[model samples]
Structure formats: C-alpha cells, structure tokens
Target chain A: MIHLYQNNGYNIVLDVNSGSVHVVDKAAYDVIGALEEQNEFHTPDTLKSPETAAYLKERLGQEYAEEDLTDILEAAAELAGQGRLFTRDVYGDFIDEVKQRKTVVKALCLHIAHDCNLACKYCFAEEGEYHGRRALMSYEVGKKALDFLIANSGKRRNLEVDFFGGEPLMNWQVVKDLVAYGREQEKLHGKHFRFTLTTNGVLLNDEVQEFVNKEMDNVVLSLDGRKEVNDRMRPFRSGKGSYELIVPKFQKLAESRNQQKYYIRGTFTRNNLDFSNDVLHFAELGFKQISIEPVVGEDTDPYAIRREDLPRIFEEYDKLAKIMVDREKSGRGFTFFHFMIDLEGGPCVAKRLSGCGSGTEYLAVTPWGDLYPCHQFVGQEEFLMGNVEEGLTRPDIGDAFRGCSVYSKEGCKKCFARFYCSGGCMANSYKFHHSINDTYEVSCEMERKRVECAIMIKAALADA
Target chain B: MKHIKTLNTQTLNNTVKKGGCGECQTSCQSACKTSCTVGNQTCENRK
Candidate 1:
C-alpha cells in the first residue's frame, strides 16, 4: 500500500509494505495517486499495459506533457517492478512464521511498588493500587522475577527489567536489591541485564540519582507540563502541586545523566490541548528527551480526548514538527518520543508484525509476583498469566496476545502507519472493544498523525 | 515538473540527523506501554 500526503512543503509517498519512501513533485504525486485510483494492487502486466498508458495520458492530459507523464509512469512502473512501490502484501507469508516462532521472554516491566505516594488524576494505575491493595514487591519476589527472566529468556542475552510503580522510590531498597542480584546472576546465566526505573519524582533525591546513574540503563521521570497543568491532575495526597517539588529533581537527573538517556514523559489532556507548548516548555527546562502522551479516558471523564479535539491536536502536531526542525537547526533540539521514527533499517518484520512482543517476549510482573501482558494490564485479573514462581500457568492468555498484529487489528489492517505503530496499544484495544485484535479510533488517528509528522520532520531536516 | 527522489532500504533517510546506538533495553515495551517508537533510549548508548 502507498500513502501520499503533503507536509512541511514536501510531497511524500510511502510504500508501506516495502518500507520505501519517495519525495515526489506535484505531478509525479498525482500520477501515483491516479494509478492507485485505478488499481489498488499493481501487477506487472497491469503496469506495462498500453491500455494503462493511454488511460494515464487520457486522465491527466492537460496537467503535463504527455512525454513527462509517460516518463513518470515508466519510472513508477519500474519501481513497482523492483518491489519498491505499489508492492503486494508479501508479509502474509511470514504471519505463520511469527506465530510459530519459539519466542522467549526478553524484558519484564516489573511493578516494584503497586502503591503510590501522590495521586494523579489521569493515572491508569489508579494511583498504583491497580484495583488491588497497596503493596511493594518483596526482594524475594523481585529476585525470582529476575531469575524467571534469565530462565525463560532462552538464547536471548540482553534482558531488561523496568522498575515501574506508583513510585519505585516507595520501595527503593528492593529495587536496589534486585539490581544487585540481577548483576550477580548475569554472568552465571550468560545474560546481560538492563535495568530501568519510572517514577513521579516526589521521592527523588541525591542518593537515588547517584544509584540510578550507576545502575540504571534508562529512567522515566513523569511530569505533566507546566505548574498549573501538572498540579491540577497530579497533586500530592494533601492536595499540593508536584510541579515545584519535582522540576528541580527532574532537571538535576537529566543533567547528571546523559540527557538523551532519560525521558521526561508527560500526559496531555483536554486541559492541555495545546501540548506543543508543553513540549517546548520541557525544552525550556533543559530536557533533551521528552514524551507527552495523550490522556485517553472514558468519555465521561472531563479530560478524555474526544474526536473533536483531533483537528486542533493535528494542527498542534504540525506546529510542533516545524518547531522541532527550527530547534534542531539552532542546535538546541530535543527528542520527542512520538515523533521519532526510523524510515531505514527499522525493526525486523517480526517486530513490525507483532509489536513490543507483549504477553509473549515482554511481560509485566506485579508487586505480588503475578504476571500480566503489560503494565497497562496490571490490575486486569483476566490477563493473569501466572507468577515468577510457577511461570506462565495461563499460557493461553499470552498466546492470545501473540496472535495480535497489524493484520489482525481491524483498524490497523489498512493503516499506512501499521508497521510504525504496531497495532496501537493492546490495553487500549481491550478497554475499548474487550478484545486485543480490535483497536480504538482516537489512538489510531493520533498514531497516523505522529507518523506523518515524523516523516515530515525527517524530510524538512533533510532539506534544511 | 518532475521532482522525485526514491529511497529504498539501503538509501533510507534517517529521521534523527545524529546517528548512534539505536538499541535500548525495554524501550520497545515502554513506548505504547508495549513498544518503543524509534527503539530504546537506554543510557548504555551513552557509555
């Protein structure tokens, strides 16, 4: 499938299946669009047909010289002939291979502290209880979690453990213990452990930063933009804003570590629809890597992103793309996570087809040692796949997620951003439709725009 | 009127101008709470 669009003064064409990208002039873009209008799939005979050539000239006769039109047609046809444009879905053959592969666990999002110190309004973890009692994973459970990862990882050498929580600092000691244990076990198991931590920064201090710099591979610090915006949704239990308390900590951590090694991730709701400024706001505070996720909640929730917000949100993304280009050119650029896409040498087809490998190669472990498909599905009892002790008692649940793919999702099947987004978020799908194969419209729309913006930024930077 | 530049696997333009290690542990699983958008951003790359 080919997607054509104009963004930031560049007319871009993406051959989705083959991962080939082309920047074409208006006339060439129109020629390709015409061919798509005639036939969705391009076969060799259909490309070289005299009837097709006559049809192209007849359809676009006034727009260009017949010779130029003919030349473009030949070029497009040759590109298609070489499997670079209008390519058929050759990925269908690999679907079975993706399903049949003996996938091993490579990463675990370990919910170290199921309890949280602060109350965030838009938090999906329900302030870290996850619909259960507030708790922290014991060192025993954390050790077994790492051991389980090393055991189930098969031949994979790089194993990941993310210390995620309502606040990992709430259970700081166990986190340190697990890291130490993970390090000790790595050489023996022939595995390398990459530990990460995600926190709200209320508990961040000099000691934590020192330990993090030494042991953590990446750290995710959450803050929801400006003072008022952040305080409104994410307040302390005593009803205080966290912005003033955490900003300095976040800044110090980013400055201490390689700036690119950490992400200052925030969430934008209807309250902060102009999130581009929020992104710029982060840049102002000296963050070089930022991710502001959309706050998706029930329609009844005040902050839930509605369909009407899309146009404004889309414009914001367009505006941000230009700003990013300017910033990069000025040598003060930051990496916006969503706008990051690799056009070349992207993830393997197996990864593109099956995303993140959740419920399969990547799993989430709860504080009490229960397993789920991912952190988003932490409290979801239905997703329980067993614990580190028994190891995958409900393998069927993981198998179900393994079956999901861009081809499997109704919305993602025809999406040009399918390979990039990898079927949206499974937890989101389950929430909207009660099935993983199904996905929601809002996320799909957001993802497609990000892909376009990412491509535009790439093109604009190339031009600049 | 003809302005087209075609790039395949080998000639694909990178979105980020700077090139370094793209692999990061758990980055994929973090993005969507399941996948990383451009790959991992682990600090080991810094090392």
Candidate 2:
C-alpha cells in the first residue's frame, strides 16, 4: 500500500511495504493518486490500460500535458514493479508465520502500590488504586509476577518489568525485594531482567535515588513543568503544589545518572497550550531525556484537549522543533521523545503492522495479581487476561489484541502516517470508542503534525 | 540502501493542499465523531 500527503508545502508519498518516503512534484503526486484510486475501484491486474491513461489525463490534464502524464504513469508503474506502490497481500505470509508461533509475555508492568500520595486530576488510575480499591502489591505477588514473566518468555533472553503505581515508592520495601528476587531468578534461569520504575518523585530521597541509579535500568520521573502549571495539575492530597518538593530531587537524580536511560515525563492539558515552554524548562533544569505527552481523558473535563486547542498545540510543536534545532546548533542537544524517529532504521513491516505489543508481548499486573493489557486497562474487567497463577486464562482476548493492526483498520490503510503511528493507542481506542482497531481523530491530527515537523527538522539539519 | 529525497526550496514553494479531516468544513466535534466512526463495523468483526 501507499500513502500520500502534503507536509510543509511539499508533496510526500510513503510506500508502506518498501519503507520508502519520496518527495514528489505535483504532477507525480496526482498520477500516483489516480493510480491508487483506480486500484481501489478495480483489481491490481487491470491497473495498466490505455483507458487508465486517458482517465488520468482527463483528471490531471490541466496541470500536465499528455506526454508528461504518460511519463508519470510509466514511472509510477515502475515503482509498482519494484514493490513500492500497489503492494497488496504483502502481510499474508507474515501473518501465517506469526499465527503458528507461541504468544509470550516479554514485558510486565507491576503495580507496586495501588495507592498514591498525590492527587493528579488527570491520573488514569483514578489517583493510583484504579478507582476500585486502595492496596499495595505484596512481595509474594511481585515475586510470582517475575516468575510468570520468566516462564512464559519462550527463549527470550532479556525481559522487562516496570515498577509502576500511583507511587511505587509507597511500597519501597517490596520493590527492593522484587529486584533482588529478579536477580536470583536471572542467575537460575540464565535470562536477563531489566527493571524500570515510574515515580511521582514525592518519595524520591537519597536512598531511593541511590537504589534507582545503581539497580534500575531506567527511571521515569513525573514532573509537569513550571511550578504553577505542575502544581495546579499535580497537587498533593493536602492541596499544595509538588513542584518545589520534587524538582530538586528530580534534578539530583538526573544529575546522578549522567548517561543513563531516564525521562522527565510531563503531561500537557488544555490549560498549558504553550507546552513548549515546559519542555524548555526541563531542558534548562539539566534533563537530557524528556517526554511531554498530552493528557488523556474525556472531553467533558475542563482540562482535556478540546478541538479549539489544536491550532495552539500545533504552534507549540513548531516552537518545540525550533528549540530542538537551536539546542543542536549550540552543541547541547536533548532528546525529545516525540521527535526521535529512526527513519534510517525503521521497524520491520511486521512490527509496524502489529502496533505496540500490548496484549501479546506485554501485560500489566494489578496489586492483587489480576492481569490486563497494559497499565491503562488495569481496572477494566473486560480487558482482564489472567493472573500470575492462572497464566493467561483469556487467550481469546490476547488473540483479539494481537489481530489488531493497521491492516485491520480501514482508515489507517490509506494514511501517510500509517507506518509511523500504526493505528494509535489501543487503550485510547477502547476508552473512547470501545474498539481496539478504532483510532482517535485528535491523536491522528497531533501525530501527523509531529511527523511533519520532524521531517522539516531533518530537512533543515541536512541542509545545515 | 534506499534513497530518500528531502523537500527542497522549489518543492516547498508549491501550493499546499489539505486532505482527510484537515479539509473538513464541519465543527471539530462533529467531524471527529464522523471520521472516527468510519470503520466501526469492520472493527467489530475483528473483535
């Protein structure tokens, strides 16, 4: 399949199967569009015909002469022969092979504490206990979760387990025990375990930072931005701002792990339309990795991103891109999560087709050991796959999640951002539309703008 | 190695066009509801 769009005044064409992106002229773009439209109406075998050429000339004749139209069609046909355009049925073999293989859980999100100290309004987990009950994952459940990941990993050498919660530090002792347990299991099973911790930084003291720096593979520190913005959105249960308390601790942690994998993750709401300033604030505080994600909630909330905020959000992205370029020019470049696209070494077609490996390769275990697709779906019983003891009792749910891909989504099949986005977040789809394959249109717009901005940055850097 | 052609000055100067939701004239809420519901039936079959 192929996708076409306009970005920064340039006509861009993406060949999904070939993983090639071309910047074509208007004439070529029109010809490719006509060919794709015809293929949609008819069959692939009947793509080339004198009548096809006539139809193309009739549609695009005012822009191009008959000879130029013929040449453009011939070039498009050549691309088709090379398996760039009109590439249908390319995923059948891969699908068959995947079906015959065992579905293993490679990564697990362990909810260390169902309770949190902070009262972030946009907390997806209903302030950490998932709005159902307040609890903490015992050492017994945590150890069993590690064992489950190792047993079901199926020849995978490196497995990932993230210490997640309303605040993982709330159950600090159990987290320490699980790390030690994971190390013991790794030695016994000859597998490697990589642990990550996501914290709100309220309980990040010297000891916690030391343990995180020494043992954890990565740490996700949650701090929104400027003191007022963060405090307004992520206030403590006592009704005080957490920015001052956490910023110094986060700065120290970031400084201690000079070259380690850590991100200062922030969430932007309707209140902070100019979130580029927040990103710059993190950069100024000496953070090397930053991820600023939009808040996910229903539109009824006052802080949810509304349709009117899109224009300002797009402008903020452009401003962020400019800041990134300036930082690179000054030799102090920091990595923004959204702009880090590996165009040269993109994911293989199978990986792109399957989207994020939520159910099949990844799962989240709640405090009581109930399993869900990911952290977002922890409380939803319909998403429950199984517990550590039962080991994936709902294989049908797993199969359904594994079957969801861009190939299954009708609108995504023709999007220029299909390979990059892979049909968006399944949790969002399930929450908004109650379907795994459906995509949020707001996310689609945001992602397309980001892709366009990234491409423009690459172009500028190339010319520089 | 595959070749990727970057956007140049001439190509960047061409007239820009909008497709999909970018060109829709309806309100954002109405347009999004319509666009996101395009393939609901097909999605249900897969589920």
Candidate 3:
C-alpha cells in the first residue's frame, strides 16, 4: 500500500511497508483515494481542511496557472501522509532513490575524421593553425570504444553512438563499421540504439546518404543561408568558394528518401546579422526544421553579434516556423520546430537547464581518444574529462565537475533566469574567459530576451 | 536456539555486503538538462 503527501509543491507517495516514497501523478493519487474510500472503515468520512479547499481553488483556477495541476496532485500526497500510509523512512530515502534513477551516458563520441573537405570560417575546429594538423580516427579506436560502451551497460537506458568531427563521413568506412558493431551490441543488450551525425554536406554521396537514411536517427546538416553569404563564410581549403559544391549536395540529400530525418543548421555572422531576409530565404529551401546560432568572437571583435539583435532574428525564425507548421498542417508531410518548447516543459533528455550537459551526460572523444567535456574543447586541456581507455572511474574528475556549479554560480544564483539558464555552457565560459570559474551573465541575458520573444509568440497565437 | 539462528545469519552476511544503486556513480542527467543555454550563437546561424 502507498500513501501520498504534498510537500514543497511536490507530489510525494509513501510506501506502507518499507516507508520508501515515490512521486506520483494526479491519476495515481485519485486511484488511491478511490481505493481508500471503498474501504470505508480505513479512512474517515469527514473531509480535511487543506486538501478539500485547495483542490477546489486549484481546479477552478487551472486556466490561470499552467502549474496549478501540479498543486492539486500534491494535495493527494498530503492526504496519504496524514492517513499514516507510510513510515518515516519512505520520505527520507525518496531523494536518494530519485538520484539513483537518473540517466547516464553509456557511449562516447567517435570522431571518424578530423579533416573537412569544405572549411567554414567561423568553425572553432578550423580556427587559426589547428586546421592544418587534422587527423582521421582509425577503425581500431571505433571498435574499442564500441566495446567499452557495450561492456558498461548497467546504468544507461539508451545507448547513442554519435559520429562528429571535422566531418564524420569524411572517412565513411569507420562509420559503417561502428554502426554495424553498435547494432550487434544492441542485439546483445536488448537496449535501443540511437545514432546522430553532424556534418558539412560536401562529402555526403549516394551510398553515404543511403547508409545515413537506413542507420542514423538524426542528421544535422550545415547550411549558411543564401549563395553569396554561404560562399563568403564557408570556402574550400584552397580559399575557393564552396557554395556551389555544397548546394548541389544539399539538393541531392534533400531529394533522397532520407531527407525527412535531416535538420538544417546555420551559423549567423556579423556580416549576416542584418539579413533577416537571408533567414527567410534559408527557410524557403524547404527543409522542415532549422536552427540558427550566432557567431562567437572576441569581445572586441567586430564579427561578434550581440544578444540585442534577437528580436529581429526571432521575427525571422518565427516566420520560418509558421511556414513549416503550416506546411505540416496542410498534409505536406511532417516538420518539427527546432526549439521544442512544449516537449521541454518537464525534464527533457535533449537539454539541461543551463546548456547541454557537456561534462557529465555527454563526453566528446577526440580522434586520438582523448576525452573532453565536449567537442568544443577538442584542443583545450582544461575540459579533458578522462581518456577513453582509462575510462570515467576516477574520483578527481567527478569531484572537480561537482564543485563547478550549474546553478550556484555567484551571478546565476541572483539572476531571474537561473532556473532556465543554469549558468550557460561551462566550456564556453572557460575558453573565452581563460577561467573555468566565471558567471554566465551574457548567456542568461540572451535567454531572458529569448523568453520575451517566446511570450510574444504565445500571446499572438493564444486565440489561434 | 534464537542465538544460533542470529549467528547463522551473521555468518551468511559475511559472503555478501550491502551495496547502493550501482558501481557507476551519478546517473542523473539533471546536470545536463540544466546546463543548456537556449541561444547557442554557434547554432543560431543554422536557422
């Protein structure tokens, strides 16, 4: 038997026997309440003061507060505890149990190649002299990494083998082998296999496109809007324009049967910051979903676009979303929003509050098998988590990361958007500031502004 | 007789020790979900 309680706006259920507590939803509470009511002698007929009135008020005002449902569910928890449905141990162990249930990354990044056919100017990987010393990962490392992921199968529910690099398919053989190996492992473990690749579409051919269609779960392609802008930003290693080469490949891949699995990614630069028209032009390309990210530069660099330009960007982005949404509604196949705000209401697997969990939930393994917090810190020593061979069994790495607060950054604690921002990306903070320890004020400011846009979008579509 | 049963249980307990969730520590993706900043300028251009 389980009893429920509402504490601190959380719905908590207490186990009658071991006193172990579980958090339950509204339906679960209602079922228990009905059961208790059926056994007339087990529960009192007279209604409680807090639960009854609170439920009435919350149910009546459900339209006013989006979170009112949570409040009502918690009331059931309060009732369960008052009825002595559980012992003290149930409540005490609940937090620890929840921590135990958290998801862990079972696999690591396998960088198939570090050499790109087309070089983008704003790419962090190709910035400065580091571009010349690119390397490709061997099949040997891919096998070892896959084996390691398969062996450590205790904690993770879904095993994701992501191919990232200068461009993953630059060496397609290794990717093929890894995918085959991952499938075998999936058969053995009985857990689902998820694969994703981020690439510059230059090297993607018919065979590669077919393999991606059949195997990969998500594919993110790089496109920098119109021809002139793309040519200016992304060129060949010989400094020739790559827009012609990339656009044809994009067309080929889009025409492929696997086009539905792809999403468009564009990087905004200072040159293109004023070109909201360019964004609309990119949307006109017929890709169902797209993501636009601003370029990062030195504080003094003229290339860096400030967060103030978001309103215009938001307008362009919203237009694109509307087009895509309309297309889907009109039975022109399916298109998804890159920012799935509705799906991310609760705990989302794709994102964390501050940023993607670079240090913990995800690890970026370089071509040399050196482990870093993420791909963004490939050359940087500060973000190294552990080596692929030695594994994540060390104490110091976890301790250092734990001490680095996602929420408790000095400035973040006071920021209004702390819950949503989570101190931004720690790796970005370290690389630009030359310190692992710093406040994420700029990212938070950008997020608050974005939220303002979201509010406007909600209001505009409230009646629709 | 009760003393004998307690001693028997103690001897059996020596073969196995109590353990927590798993040898792998901290399965929580709470840290990751919390870490994402919405407007990643790098990805912002992709739109």
Clash pairs, model 2 backbone: none
By lDDT rank, best first, the candidates go 1, 2, 3
Residues A261-306, model 3: lDDT tens digits: 5666676677786454555565566655555556666566665655
Q: What lDDT is reached at residue A214 by model 3?
A: 86
User: Which of the two, 1 or 2, has more TM-score?
Assistant: 1
User: Per-residue lDDT of A1-464 in model 1, one digit per residue for the tens?
Assistant: 89999998889998887778888888899988998888989766787899888889899988989888888888888888777788877676767767767778889999999889899998888988989999989999999999899999887788888999878999999999889999999989888888889999999999999999999888888998888889999999899999999999999999999795788989999999999999999999999989898986988999999999999999999999999999999999999999987665455555566666788888899988999988888888889999999999998987898888877777877889887777777778888888888878888898889989988888878777
Maximum-lDDT candidate: 1
Compute DockQ for each candidate against the true complex: 0.21, 0.05, 0.06
> Which parts of model 1 have CA positions greater than 4 angstroms off?
B11-28, B31-47
Candidate 1 C-alpha lDDT tens digits along B1-47: 24668744532122222322223344454533533353222223334
Q: What's the lDDT of the predicted structure labeled candidate 1?
A: 0.82
Instruction: Please give the lDDT score at residue A257 for candidate 1.
Output: 95
**Model 2 TM-score on a 0 to 1 scale:** 0.82
TM values, all candidates? 0.94, 0.82, 0.66
Q: Assess each prediction's global lDDT (C-alpha) against the native.
A: 0.82, 0.73, 0.52
What does candidate 2's lDDT look like per residue over B1-47, in tens digits?
Answer: 11235332211001111111111111101111111111111111112
Candidate closer to the true structure by lDDT (higher is better), 1 or 3: 1
lDDT, residue A47, model 1: 76
